[model samples]
Target: MNGVLKALALPVVLFTGWWVLSADSESFYAPPLSQILTAFGDTWTLEQLKADVLPSLLRLFAGFLLAALIGVAAGVAIGSSRRLRAVTEPVLEFFRAIPPPVLVPVIMLFAGIGDAMKVIVIVFGCVWPILLNTVEGVRAVDSVVLETARSYGVTGTARITRVILPSASPQIATGLRQALSIAIILMVISEMFAASNGLGFTIVQFQRSFAIPEMWSGIILLGLLGFGLSLLFRLAERRALRWYEGLRAAQRSS
Candidate 1:
């Protein structure tokens, strides 16, 4: 309860302040909170949700999942072998340095302004953190564990599945958490660049038309969406890393 209250306190304070400050305001750009909420309630109908929200979520999930799979696989391969890591480190760094938004136009040229381009953009943006973290996690695994697994005749997939992945899961989870925010940002940026339908496009459309309240509503919805995804990810991470967390706690207690 205390934790919940602490979490709610800031939002409550901010909302109250916003309500009070905008109560008698007449700013065109910054519509009153009540008006924004009203517009939000009105514009976010079932159909709009299906059309805009669903597509954005689909792209987000599809791209993120792809990034996760590829990142983990590549990270494992590179991390487990010193030669491979040496060979790939510079290339990875170079690519990772490039801003994802810069690739949107180039990707669009190749993939066109379609779902493929958007997913590609998101995947490109999200893959680096997961890949880098997984590499670090794998490299950091205790050498004793690897030797033990090898002595037991464990090889290839068995070793990776039973030892490496489990040992590195905590770091992988961290990477995924980092990637989530990047994925969301890329999702919005991609839509803003060249798109017909999405939360980003909708917000931009409203802003262009000077529908200030509706634009604010879209922005609010995006923030809420990010918060909800974050909560869900945290819940999943807690479940997935339960053993790792328990081990740490035990060590601390000792």
Candidate 2:
């Protein structure tokens, strides 16, 4: 109850203040809070929301999941192999520096204006942070732990699955959290570029038609969608990092 109150109080206060002030504002930039809320409510008919939001969410998830799998795998390989790391580190850093939006036209050339291109762009944007973090996590694991596992005839798949990967999971979780944020950003960008049915497309459509309220609604919905996905990722991270929590507890006690 205390924690909940602490969390809710600031937002409640700020929102109420905004709604009250904006209720009387004459500036075109300052739409009434009620008007914004009403726009949000009216535009979000179940059918329309389902038609737009779901496609955007599906693309986000598909690309993010694929990136996580491949990134983690490649990160582990690179982290463990000096030669591979040497070969790929510069390339990874190079691509990571380039903005993902720039890849849209290049990806379009190869994949066209399709789901593949959207997913590809998302993966390109999201994977580097995750892959890099995974490498750091793997490399940072305690050498004693690695040697102890080796003493028990544990190496290869068993080493990774039972020891290295588990030890790296908290960092991986952190990376995934970052990746989720990037994924949402790229998802909207990709939709705006080439999509027919997503929140981004709707926002563009309403903007072009000069439907300001509806455009505001799409923007608000995108924010809510991003917030919801972030909350879910945080919850999953808490669950997945239980062992890491225990380790922290032990360290603090000592």
* Candidate 1 whole-model C-alpha lDDT, 0 to 1: 0.94
TM-score of each: 0.96, 0.94
For residues 89-179, what per-residue lDDT tens digits would candidate 2 score against the true structure?
Answer: 9999999999999989999999999889999999999899889999999999999999999999998899999998998888888888899
For 1-254, candidate 1 gives per-residue lDDT tens digits of 46446666887898899999998878888878999999999999999999999999999999999999999999999999999999999999999999999989899999999899999999999999999999999999999999999999999899999999999999999999999999999999999978999999999999999999999999989998997798779878888888988999999999
TM-score of 2: 0.94
RMSD values, in order shown? 1.3, 1.6
Q: Name every residue pair that clashes in candidate 2.
A: none
Name the candidate that leads on TM-score: 1
After the best TM-score superposition of candidate 1, give how far the Cα of residue 116 lies from its true spot, in angstroms: 0.3
